[model samples]
Target chain A: MTTAADSTVQSAPVRPFAQALKDAQTRITTHMDARLGGDDALHAAMRYAVTGGKMLRGFLVLESARLHGVAEAATLEAALAIECIHAYSLVHDDLPCMDDDDLRRGQPTVHRKWDESMAVLAGDSLQTFAFELLADPRIGPHGLTLIRGLAQASGKDGMVSGQMLDIAAETATRPLDLEQITHLQNRKTGCLISWSATAGAVMAGADEAPLRRYADALGLAFQIADDILDVEGDAAKVGKAVRKDADAGKATFVSLLGLDAAKKRAKTLMEQACDALTPYGDAAETLKDTARFVISRDS
Target chain B: MTTAADSTVQSAPVRPFAQALKDAQTRITTHMDARLGGDDALHAAMRYAVTGGKMLRGFLVLESARLHGVAEAATLEAALAIECIHAYSLVHDDLPCMDDDDLRRGQPTVHRKWDESMAVLAGDSLQTFAFELLADPRIGPHGLTLIRGLAQASGKDGMVSGQMLDIAAETATRPLDLEQITHLQNRKTGCLISWSATAGAVMAGADEAPLRRYADALGLAFQIADDILDVEGDAAKVGKAVRKDADAGKATFVSLLGLDAAKKRAKTLMEQACDALTPYGDAAETLKDTARFVISRDS
Candidate 1:
């Protein structure tokens, strides 16, 4: 059942960005399956929720680890951990009380496929599992630092706060301005992205400033690309409903900045992201490709 | 604003269990307030969710830390962390899709007070906050071990799995037998309590066998007492609806064992819990009182 992407990644160090992404997807899914083996419903739902994603955050972790000379063994687990967090957020966000999406990754959302209670439990456990993975001794003495960083990046002050703001925005008197939207997206999506990209430096006990700068730009570009996709991409290719934000009259980069300007802005951020990696020289080619891919991908 | 119970605990070690519990509540609340200082709706909900519980788990953490000579500064955070986990569980469990509970601790549930989205986000953030608290350097180098332990105790194979089983049991063709009930309760309520009771040993890198044994008995006794309260206690005293289990025809400890037998079993377990604390002798008096309180208290 191995795909060409998997074989290519396994065969050589010089992988195309697509192949590397698929490779991360395969490795993380395999790792997650091994660790979460059981017949229980919650585990089954958890497995389902984590599967079928693009695994971009995971690729960032692996690539960053490779750049920092950290072992794949440790980074792979951290990669899986971030995916768990990502998947869990998606699960809860898809709940009826939240964004209320019926589809995710071209499949029924967790609540639609199973039940809301299962979705809640599965999401809850997946979050706990993320912390559990980071606490592994293989991550070395920096495990606490990583754990603390993640807790800050994803907790009340970070991702969740971003979500709260998004919900509040939906009911506000007017659409959010650009500054507010930037703040919200930074917390909602950018924080985890930054965390994933900088994890390698943290694990290596090296300076994380370079990766942080790269990630900050890269994350915003990725989100702008997402907004573009929502406006222009087909649902089939995008793997979820599109244009819903526009339909609901919700403000997004594409709406606030105009579609053409939004795309140009994404390109600028992508360049800034690549420039931030200048310290790593040609060794950061894969990351440069990743930055390019972020602005270009439809999904 | 200061109650007699709070005053008594601050003054001396010879304070009664009620005073000690109140002190734990006050201190943990203050600590949480200081840590989660934000006017954001999600933060507000998180603060509310963590408040008003009996603080029994906090007591277990503090008492066990004292027994192991761990400092209050360290254990207080650990205590607050456990409370966050406990509170998050309660908030989610009260969701309309889950237990559908309207009241908890004599107050409206999170979903009722705010909304389902707020409840979900608040509960979600609280879980993350627990790990954040544990990641504090004051907990010493054992922070990872404690984090890993908490994650395992509260994740898929532990509390979440138990909750899944409870949900499934609601529609089962046959009632769960005594063995099934024991296994379910062991995972459901027992895991976190065991973790709390043994946290001090984990923090000190000391042997945890005695505390584990005590927690096993005490956790079971606590569940039995809860069942007894469901059958015999008033709603005002219990702080939640009484006899809902009977109304729903749910099988519980009281339902299977009969009232008198259940009471006797709980008493025996209380005795066993105290017996396991013999190694600590007079220094274990508070914990022994805790075991007695578990089986005898109205709530």
Candidate 2:
């Protein structure tokens, strides 16, 4: 499901910003390669778990830093940590005991590629690596702030709690209301994305309140669009199972609000996302385009 | 099985050092209860995971801190974080997809009491909390040092990587040599124990190399003793499914070297552990006792 944001990068002159993002990821890839150093099987699992992904969170961190007019080297290290944590979460989320999805980013999930235990350890190690990278003295004290934000967003109060709520919601007999579904989605998916943005702002030294507002809107908008895609997306283009929400009997925005209302809600949230960035004016144009790309694109 | 050390405390008035250790654990338990807040299921899992263990790692942290003359307030926080990581590892290790143990510390495993998914998330959250607690400013710069030591010891170079090796070793047809088995045991069991001691020393501003060496020797001796117990332990007393190692044909120290040789090795390692602490003199008696306990105790 390539978006206008993705295609624009494909067709246009590769902006230095995009190239910088690539270079940053390349550096992370190298660092991660060394971190997971061992025999072929372990290294393969580690690389496979991280190398393929939406990289949306990475995009968010990079764009957020750009918005703040800071290109500090430490910001790149922080962005890499955010991406590593995001990747680790996805790997664990797809385990057989969890979401049980066999495919991610058009490839077999980590557990399917290796085994469940290896996948678990790989995910666990990658997660630890995120904090290690953030705490590296070479990256300076800036890493501590990054680590704190990630810990809050990924730990009990953030993604893990959201996952518990989502799984419980799946098992419940009663139909969840829109707010209930939204709340679950906001925590499960929105929190990490929100952290990605806010972490970048912290790395670039942006104002606290405005960054929080921007992150909150962007996260919710991203999740609403994701729910919309699960309903309307093409399996061939999406490269994974679609409509699993209906199949799993889980409550989703489309299920709770109807497709038309879901679409309307998604657009409204995307508008809110864009509005949240208004404080940065032209500095946030790319992020605004990303919000539209999120809501309007079809797989 | 109850140990001589535990029985000694039961019989006599609690020594001031032992009282301090209890006080440290109590403080940590109280803080955990407060932070547990409203998540009853998670809180229950956290409490269950943390409460019944021998407290060997926590003891090391407190005792090592006492040896270094660290302030009581700071040592307690360090103990909390170290214990949290240790507990989290145990909960995850006992999951059905991992060791598949039904009982731990004479009680139902977290996965047995809760569901597998909840168990996984609970462990994940606990691991995050450990780092978050260490990153708190109250511990100052030393907190980061403690966290770094912990992350390395518990991550790729430590427990997780060791678990991977243990899992692989279970199915291997070739006999594992002493070196390979020792490597696996060192990483698997030794790493975290060493981290606990070193981290305690770091908390007390003993970031020198000699203290780290002391911790390492203690860690190795601890695992050799654990292997010895697994071979000869009474299931009723140990409160665990005994003989899993022999049943699985795993190559442990007892299996590879025989019980007599394994016991001799433990004794030798204990002597080395004691020798390593000579520089700290009488202040390190508790650590020396810990090394002796590692080899001599049942459970």
Candidate 3:
């Protein structure tokens, strides 16, 4: 029952949230810069492609890691790995052969800044780097688990599968029903979001069943909220392409269920997501608020 | 001291090599089928792209694992992972945005067979799957090390770096010297090939330093042989798009130093590659033979 505005004021404004978020961004960029330092063009492409994104995935990872008491340096590797995978997906998704967008995060896409081939290699390098980061000895065997979890979320059965479905939906003669649209979005966008959160919890050493349920609910809720915002949000606020879904005639929550119904579904999902976090006491309170922010934010 | 025809005769005779190779092909396809169910087009891309190629990388893995006394089951996952990475690389390399090649191993490229988007996703899926395979619990903590070694070989500092240099080489006004060209080819092609052998050895619990040295020498020797073959080999023998290197005016051993000097350099490299196996006694003879076969073979 805790509303977003109330929690924003009542909780000492989550002092660490903004700084932690900044730290995560810095960590991600530092690793990215070091990894892609060979050529000036390559470095510029990697930089232009990665900067200015809303760190939603990073937030999920850091919040979840914090909830699980995973303060050790070992956990930083896992957190960075999650962000790298997310960034790689975005880079590829923006290619001319895929989404074909000229801008990402309010700047020229990698292909726009550099050539398409360089962009392709940049994304490829980034994706490979994610696994390499996790394989670092500092994280020990936990890095292995993180790598496996990420591969599952990002590979064929998860994100890639979702993308194929999205591509199919674009050309399908029959309009996708609510169930089908939800299924596609859940896999396409939600899988990694969920994985980011659950990876943190798992790093914290949370039990398997609770982690599964928590990730599943949080992932779905996050996507629904994102879909809702895509229809009503500002491009300046989101710092990326907005309403492009509608422009592309892509199946979305607003299209299938109408804005009112979509809003209702998002609220319901948010409650389910919060309920999944209830047993963790005050340690998980910020995660619950974060879920609300995911829905209610202008972006 | 060994020669190509002698090594060919020693390599399980033509009959057994055919049969065992066929069996290995069956095993690989069956494993892929089980992993990627029949429903997805991504699976189709994976199946069509991975199967039927010459299992040279697989041969490296199996021979090295056997040399290190690894059980078949223990090495299967690592071997599969190596092949997946190799397949993924070929798929991307053949993309219209990259090499723009139309044929691979005498079959239509994945992008030509399917659409470009599906080919990209298939390659991406296969790449991630390689890491997942290495991270399999069945492989244990050594799985982590194996994944790291493979990822490092395929990543920015390794294979991808080689690719960037390759792209730049096409436009460079100054012809690269022998060392630069050798470094490029070794990193571009040899890194992954070396990884194929090193991964098998790692999974088999070989000593790290020795395995690393062996993989390095074998990789360089393999590239040297490839450069020699590119100058003089026929397409019917190589089963690949031959002589494209010369057509592109790319920097290579043959281009930099002419055919005879290139051949002699290859011999020196082959000897170095073979000498790397001294630590493992007669057990590593097949792998050593493989190194010699790599440089000495016409194909």
Candidate 4:
């Protein structure tokens, strides 16, 4: 059945921020379904793992694309690509050798629901699918830029580096300091967010400086919010275990800056993110609100 | 540090198959080294995992690209991309949850050398790097075609599917038949090999039908030879534990067809592979030699 979010996007623009996000989620999810559709068990596992997320990364893609006046067809593909990347990361992160989580988004992790081998293959394939989506000819010549940027952001120097640091910290004699934690968060979470936010400018061959600036602040704020939520969120609502970082004595924005300071900093960065969109003026309304929502989100 | 393989490619046409294979290995390894030169431990792991293989898949790409008159620089990048993909698969396959092999290429597997988590991330990152390499603009508009094909060949319906079936076979009540085994090997081993063989044609936008025909037969023969090697080859020379498939009671080509019949089938397919190269004639002498080498190699 079609969701309200799906209909809202189909109807047209200027929806409320929450509605707009839901719309992007619905649209991207549908696109993903089309891309991943098959009766095979592998496809089932892929779809199951991809669903239930808020699609925040995808919304960032759509908003950025919309702001740049990129056509929805191609924009949707880019959105799907980012979401696939995000989803693949989560699936792999939840594997037995990684975070070892049993539950994610209120459901059993892929390895928990299927076997670890299947989880590994499913995660592997999902990642390949993300690149497949980007390689679509409709993404145009500049799509190569998006594809390359994504590889950098999601691969070694970005998310993977962040994850390695986090894993190393677990066995370290000393706790990671504020700078280290910031670096980690920037890669683990911020890289993809920044990529998502700047995608519109990249595809349009427009100045990416503004979007890059906006995403730089927005990504850090988003992480700070995540740190704040870990300390404050209820498992029933958050759909995953919280306070694990604190319990593990891992350095986090909250642990390093303290909850109050972290919250204050997130607010400041949120404002900075909003300010960065000034060049686009009224055209960036959705992005401006997205910055606010990053901090305000409960899940 | 340069091996005989390095000198063969640099020198010129009509090197012996052994030297041609070595040259492809040396060139591809150098490219991979340059591409993976970060000081980070992840890079170290990526490099280590990518090294020491026979580089047969890479040889296929370079030889095929060479046959198509594609530039060496662009062909080398594609070769590196496939090697990265191959290395990633091996790393993940050697993980505790997958094939669980402790030795690969006569050395400790990545997980054994480092840890399971690092192996996972290293493998994950290597796979990402493959796409990144293909996305290089030097691959040009055809890069998209290569990227898309790589994704298909390496993702669900290709290599991963073959792996899933292999894992599933471990617990099945009935052993897979010859047809099922062929199907499994086709995806598991054939897909990427076929992609490697056909890459030159894809890059040139030339007719790929003949190469496709050659790869289809050659891939099966390669697997049958591998099966024969598992039963008859030495672990020291083969660079990994041999006879494990037979010991596990797996329904390999050798198991279903008998060693002699499997060998005969491989020879038949090898001839078919050579015959398919008739269109390119002498221009494809190197590839024809590769088909012969596939059935004759020790590892």
Best by lDDT: 1
lDDT (tens digit, per residue) of candidate 1 on B1-299? 22212221113233477787888889888888888788978888998898888889888999999999998788988999999999999999999999998999999999999999999999999999999999999999789999999999999989988898898989999999999999899889999999999999999889999999999999999999899889898999788999999999999999999999998888789778989999998888888878877777776
lDDT value for candidate 2?
0.73
| Model 3 residue A74 CA deviation in Å | 2.1
Clashing pairs in 4: B5-B22, B5-B23
Q: Name the runs in model 4 displaced over 4 angstroms.
A: A1-15, B1-15
Candidate 3 deviant stretches above 4 angstroms? A1-23, A27-40, B1-26, B296-299
True contacts kept of each: 0.93, 0.50, 0.75, 0.80
> On residues B216-264, what C-alpha lDDT tens digit does candidate 4 reach at each position?
9999989998998899888998999999999999999989888788877
TM-score of each: 0.95, 0.91, 0.91, 0.94
Report the C-alpha lDDT of model 2 over B203-275, residue by residue, as the tens digit.
Answer: 7676556667876777777777777668788777788888888887878888888888877777777677778
Worst 10 residues of 3 chain B by lDDT: B8-17
Q: Which residue pairs does candidate 1 place in steric collision?
A: none
Q: Which one wins on DockQ? A: 1
DockQ-better candidate, 3 vs 4? 4
Candidate 1 per-residue lDDT over residues A121-221, each given as its tens digit: 99999999999999999988788999999999999989999999999999999999999999999999999999999999999999999999999999999
The models' CA-based lDDT, in order, is 0.89, 0.73, 0.74, 0.86
Q: Rank the candidates by DockQ, best first.
A: 1, 4, 3, 2
Q: Ranking by lDDT, best first?
A: 1, 4, 3, 2
